[model samples]
Target: MSQLSETTDGHLLKAITDACDGRIIQMPGPMAVTGVYPERSPPFKTIKLKGIEEFLLASARIGNRQPIILKLTPMDAVDYEAIEIESNKITQFEALEKHLVDHLGGYFNLLLGEAGADGLDAPYIASGHSLNAAITIFRREVEPLLARIKATRLAKAEQAAALAYADNDDWGTW
Candidate 1:
């Protein structure tokens, strides 16, 4: 591998670890509550490690690859819930986008809006692409990959639930 690729991998690894640990950093944008943007009086965000790492490992085409846009679908909070519902929760994809913009701030920009048909909540520059082209590629490529990632996430969640609550039929004495 080239030195540049190695360096990038190292950096990405660090970001992934930080995100997994739930250490999030906020970026500068819309700090006013004008009935606009998702979060009022600015934005609150984090990184989505699982979905992102999986994407880099699986999708990203190496060799002369410029950064592509990384638009993320709003996460489903209750899709894999095994306990009481979390009324306020964002998905891993949302977190991953935030991480990208924070850690790689110079290379990306975060745009917040309602997640429409594509379920895209946060859109950030993964590389350098025009808006139209980015949207086209995202619709054609990233969306499908995200669906797969979500499926895997759900499966993993189910496994976690089984591990945590399996064969526990009686709650007798603390």
Candidate 2:
């Protein structure tokens, strides 16, 4: 799971930065270019975060002449960096995440409807658009059981509120 998460996080950032057509870089303090990046070269070389920000500012100023791509992976401590690059990029994840969300919402309501009518429990994959809908779907299912999860968390968080405090935690009582 950690590997998958790391891969996804790194891939997503790399994909976003690449699609943005920005240069990826790594630099040290004082704005000194300690590491000269290939400037958007493929198989992008990863580096620190501060450097990616620097490269982004530099690329943006030059009208980006080329596409800008920059990616950052959060590391330990207060310091982490991005695996940077430069290229012609596009926005896809925003749209994909939205689609995935909508699908989940539709099914969430469907599951609620089915569970209410029938007693069989089948599984389905939700993916479409609209994040709120996906959240709504998730809120529909398992949310009732969420109190158990939250209760575990709030066991020492001051006092226990009316169920869990998830902003949208309106799933009645357990």
Candidate 3:
């Protein structure tokens, strides 16, 4: 059984890296984002992680043109009720969300320019090939990995709940 402790940052990082076949590299410095690119050439198949307010922006550059952008939030992948913390659980969740957002902020600033950075809520204008290889990779690779992580967390939470309520006599027959 995977414990809640398995969701640590290192574990998550390892999972992501392994999922990408080590194509995902940790960004240097204090940024919270990671880089995804091909093993041979970069900027040809590059994906940058950025934060826009409560969302994470995945900007992928397939060629020398602009990027294909996708926005997502932790809620898009994680279930609030499925995860808990030893301390205030809500606060911990909020912190993790904020951490991811903040981590992406620096990269977002670089991708969208200063004006766009200030107005993160504004809709992004992606001007490149739509439904291309980058988006395909995101859909096939990233999204499923996130769903799997969420499923793992949800399963652990459900098991814990069942154990906790196993001895309870409050409920009548369904």
Among all candidates shown, the one with the greatest TM-score: 1
The TM-score, computed over Cα atoms with residue i paired to residue i, of candidate 3 is 0.21
Angstrom error at residue 47, model 3: 27
**What would the per-residue lDDT of candidate 2 be over residues 1-174, giving only the tens digit for each residue?**
244222322323332323333333223333321233344445334333443343332211111343233343223232323333332221223543443344444444443453342335633335542343433335344444334434544564544464355454466544
| lDDT winner | 2
lDDT, candidate 3, 81-148, per-residue tens: 11111111112234332333333333223333422223555333232312232223323333333445
lDDT of 1 by residue, 42-109 (tens): 43333223221111211111112333322222233322111110101212234544443344332212
Reference-based lDDT, residue 17, model 2: 28
lDDT of each: 0.32, 0.36, 0.32
The lDDT, on a scale of 0 to 1, for candidate 2 is 0.36
Clash count, predicted structure 1: 10
Off by over 4 Å in 1: 1-126, 166-174
Clashes (candidate 3)? 1
For each candidate, give its TM-score against the true structure.
0.25, 0.22, 0.21
Ranking by lDDT: 2, 1, 3
